[model samples]
Target: MSAVLAQAPAAEAVEDLAASLQEAGTVAAPPEDADAAIEEIGLREKESDQVIDKSDKKDPLYAISITSFEDPALELGELILKGLYEMKFSRPSKIQAASLPKIKMGRNLLAQAHNGTGKTCCFVLGMLRIVTPDTTPQALCICPTRELAKQIEEEVLKMGKYLILHKGIKVKCILRDERWERGERITEQIVIGTPGKIVSLLNMKVLDGGSIRMFVLDEADEMLNLGGLGDQSKRIRQRLRKDVQTLFFSATYTDAVKRLATQLSMDNPWSQIEVKREHIFNDQVAQYFYRTNGVTEKLERLTEILSVVNVGQCIIFVHLRDTVEQLANTLTANGHPVSPLHGRMEAGARDKVLVDFRNGTTRFLVTTNVLSRGIDVPAVTLVINYDMPVRKGGTADPDTYLHRVGRTGRFGRKGSALNMIHDEKEMVVLKQIEAYFDRQGLIKEIPPDTDGEEFEKILNVQ
Candidate 1:
């Protein structure tokens, strides 16, 4: 069997993600008892309802305002619309309401929406709408990681379930270990995969890009900024027709990423929707910091935290792969059930770890930055920065910090992100993150000596 095993979610499991989206909902009203962090990061969105179309037109689609999920401007097919509502999506989210119309218009899109803004549906719905359902690979979505690719494939299947049954729509996730016999061709109507696999297929003539109409880059910032992914992604685009409707979506973007995105659109007229920095962090996730004396104290504090708070699911992010193993062993020896995941693991083992984590069989996961982006688990209630995210030269990486905390507080569910600060050096990194987000003093500090009850009160963990 191929190392990248192919699997599909059962009909019974589709509602899990559908309910998560319903729980996520549209732009939520601000809470009454807002704190400083909430007040600072949760800016009222006034521009999220509008899309900026750069194309020249007398009657531009830039003004199409879709407040409800059933708006005719979306022009969703009967079965597709039925599946959407069945998935429990009552209305469009801020990003969805803004981007869906442009996608429906088949225009190139560059979107920078925050986490849990239903960005996946924007592209998935558009792909389903444009695809002929003949299973000829008309739409493609490229992700930065295999886990994210699998997650997206599940979303596509769930959202297009009705079309899948009656219209014969198919979705496939391409992974590095996928086996493609000589001269074999892709038959899925919509294909989601990592850049490496997609490029390999394109090179081998296994995935004919001639019929492809839409190209989506999920977590596009990572695709463009990561070492060789940018080149591979560019190669994949080269295989497709020049007129393919390219869509770039990420929670964060640097100026350089913006330039690369524009270039990828082939300088074609494209539409854009971006969130302000103040509105980037989710208000539902309470952020905190704990000061420990050293590594030993940090371990003790971590164990103590697990014993105290009611963690539905927690992800502990360390800076290195070695730390992942070390921490997992330490926690397990101390009577905690935890799983370790990293890039070095084989494809099958990695899949099992993620499957177990998503299904609630595993409550704690120790991993590197591999699981930081686009891997949504609704039950994840806590994120611990066992080690703060830093760039190659030890500078704080604000983009990664955003993604790390984003693991929790998915959609609109309440969650918490607790950062452990052991030394002055680590404290400086935290401050850098605060400065990057312009949220000074927002990450409140929890003294290491706090008792279990006090810790629970601080995090408000349910």
Candidate 2:
């Protein structure tokens, strides 16, 4: 996780940050509508639609190298800058620097950046900037899962805390099993949820789509490709106002995905800032892979690593729900406390597991891809891919692997990624991923001959 979205700053840190900003004289006086923070938004967009809808041909890598919070390109207001200062955001991330200018211009953006690169904050800032704090749904964000939706909702609330305290600003998250029934009003300034739930709400007329000024698709590739979410997402977006700014963000972008996203942008043409796949892996994570004989050998190797390595916290990723059950049961029976999360589990059960993991009460979490992309847990010093991510056709899944390894390296802290590979076939896939990332030199092989001293040094925190 990146420092930008890993966790909320401590209360004392927040105060210290505020003091530092005040001393620097960058903090502005409270707005005249201090009670509301922001006035009600007008019905139409304030920017010219035609100019923003054009595609951007700038170098994607160069586009994201911005380091200033008050970059003139973003065109953020003084009050928004003040709120950002209070959040202790010392600088804009590379992705933020690249996309904020397009965002401020009201462009229909399709951006590709690695996980934890402040993608969530980039869109949250855009949403907060456009929202008028009125009772209508000015902005809507769609995620692939409930946990991710909640994560986005949490960040939005934290970023907008000042507005809540001063102007009574409201943002709502529609999670699993929650519904906005017909005849009931949805009067939040911002709404976030899974695509299905949002579409259902729209069909029931619970949400006034015409009033939504911004539409954002987080994890755009997954929301548009997996399951039947593409149709549902399209339905939800089709209902929004014509000139609404449409945005997409994901870690990977295929040619098909780019074309689909462009088509989805509809009346507004599309633009993108794409980082090469080989360059997305976080340098903070020290990656390693161990070769084994088979499934039994892989588990044995994992158990050995767990027993030998000193980790602040750990997560083990499997590919199937049943594997999660078997591995969790086996580990617990072996006297290692752990938790399991998967798609089939009830929402309440998943929530409890995540809460425990995030609080550091549960040090180890075993799961499928459910927690791969967006959920952030504290103190995760190790991430083990017990079973490598691959598609049903046995093809490499670089995107899934990237997100899984991203679970560690929290808040710019150094961490370890251990890939457990069994057999030549799996080894080939591992090499493919290594080649895909151009990380042959960065990722090392963990030979069995290594003494405990060498292994311990590998896991040692800097």
Scored by CA lDDT, what does every candidate get?
A: 0.79, 0.73
Give the per-residue lDDT digits (tens) of candidate 1, residues 1-462. 111101122333333433333444333322333233222332223334333443334334443446556554455868887777555565566677667766765568888877776788788898888777565788899988899998888888888999999988888888999789868989988999999889888888899887788899999999888469988988888898887889999989898988888888886557777877767887778899999889998999899889889888999999999999999999999989899999999999999999999999999999999999978888898999999999988889999999999898774567899999889989999999999989898798887679998888888767
**lDDT of model 2 at position 404:** 90
Tens digits of per-residue lDDT, candidate 2, 65-125, equal: 3345565444455666767655556555556756775575566889877766667878999
Q: Candidate 2 lDDT (Cα, whole model)?
A: 0.73
Clashing pairs in 1: none
| Cα TM-score of candidate 1 | 0.87
- Candidate 1 — what's its lDDT? 0.79
lDDT (C-alpha) at residue 189 in model 1: 83
Output the number of the TM-score-best candidate.
1
**C-alpha TM-scores of all predictions:** 0.87, 0.84
The TM-score between candidate 2 and the true structure equals: 0.84
